[model samples]
Target chain A: MGLNIKPLADRVLVEPAAAETTTASGIIIPDTAKEKPQKGTVVAIGTGKKDEPLTVQVGDTVLYGKYSGSELKLEGNDYLIMRESDILAII
Target chain B: MGLNIKPLADRVLVEPAAAETTTASGIIIPDTAKEKPQKGTVVAIGTGKKDEPLTVQVGDTVLYGKYSGSELKLEGNDYLIMRESDILAII
Candidate 1:
């Protein structure tokens, strides 16, 4: 389902992918894994705020999870819409 | 212990607080806890970038973990010094 969301300048909408369950070698990782993978796809991007120009565009894959951000749901999909500053890197 | 780190514009130096280990009632949480807490304190702040002026300063507590940021270690302590863009909120 499509979402009608117009993020403010420099904000972005991201759809987080489900975390990996098993290792590449078919090793079943126990729940005690310390490193949690952070990955997601870009769904929508803001027009780039006046202060910080937008470095990333819509459809770009990104990675982040450093601070507090607002989480939202559109249709039946989950998404995170936050300021561009909240995004750490474009993968 | 102290660190000599001069964060660039809008970047911040945060000291992550240890995660909670039990519930309020002292209920020990198993390693399979789904909800991981994100919290930290601001030890240093950048001068704020050209686009977005620095909104935070040294000693201002902040929360972040959204994207990729540079990780650094000074002396014997570990720290993550990243752009202000990665910071999510000022707690």
Candidate 2:
């Protein structure tokens, strides 16, 4: 699964994980209780700022701010576009 | 007035403008109606990232996001510290 759109200027393209429907303890979570997933997989990354190269690579699973990134749909697939700084950590 | 602290790594120290008390039309705005000011004067700036030098300078008046910067008080004066990228424009 590859995207044709490329992120620019330290920005990245990410595919968000599906919302969790069940907790680790096996408790089912209702639709209304589902929060926006903060985890995603990097699909693409920018060339970075002049001297700061990106630490994340394509295929890296990362955590980001809940409100970070702009949502967009390409070919019916949802993705987020945000600066690398918006990513909190790689997992 | 000068502060002892220096902002680091693209961060900038700012003294925010006072909230609006009156509109341009002479209507007085109540405290409860006052919004956070988005304009401020730069007090100090970081050395910037390895290759991206900051565009703002000390004493420059800048416009930033209302929610941008962290609030702090030093020597009985309130200030905000944020990344230079948080600033939207120079005014």
Residue A35, candidate 1: alpha-carbon lDDT? 30
Q: Which of the CAPRI classes, incorrect, acceptable, medium or high, describes model 1?
A: incorrect
- RMSD (Å) per prediction: 11.9, 11.5
Interface RMSD of 1: 11.6
- Deviating ranges (above 4 Å) for candidate 1: A21-37, B1-91
**Candidate 2 i-RMS (Å)?**
15.7
C-alpha RMSD between model 1 and the true structure: 11.9
lDDT of 1 by residue, A1-91 (tens): 4568888877888887666554232222223223322446788887876656676677776545534358887888888887766654453
TM-score of predicted structure 2: 0.44
Clash pairs for candidate 2: none
- In the range A1-91, model 2's lDDT, one tens digit per residue, is 5455445557787888777766454434344554533878898887676778999999998878777765544456566677899998887
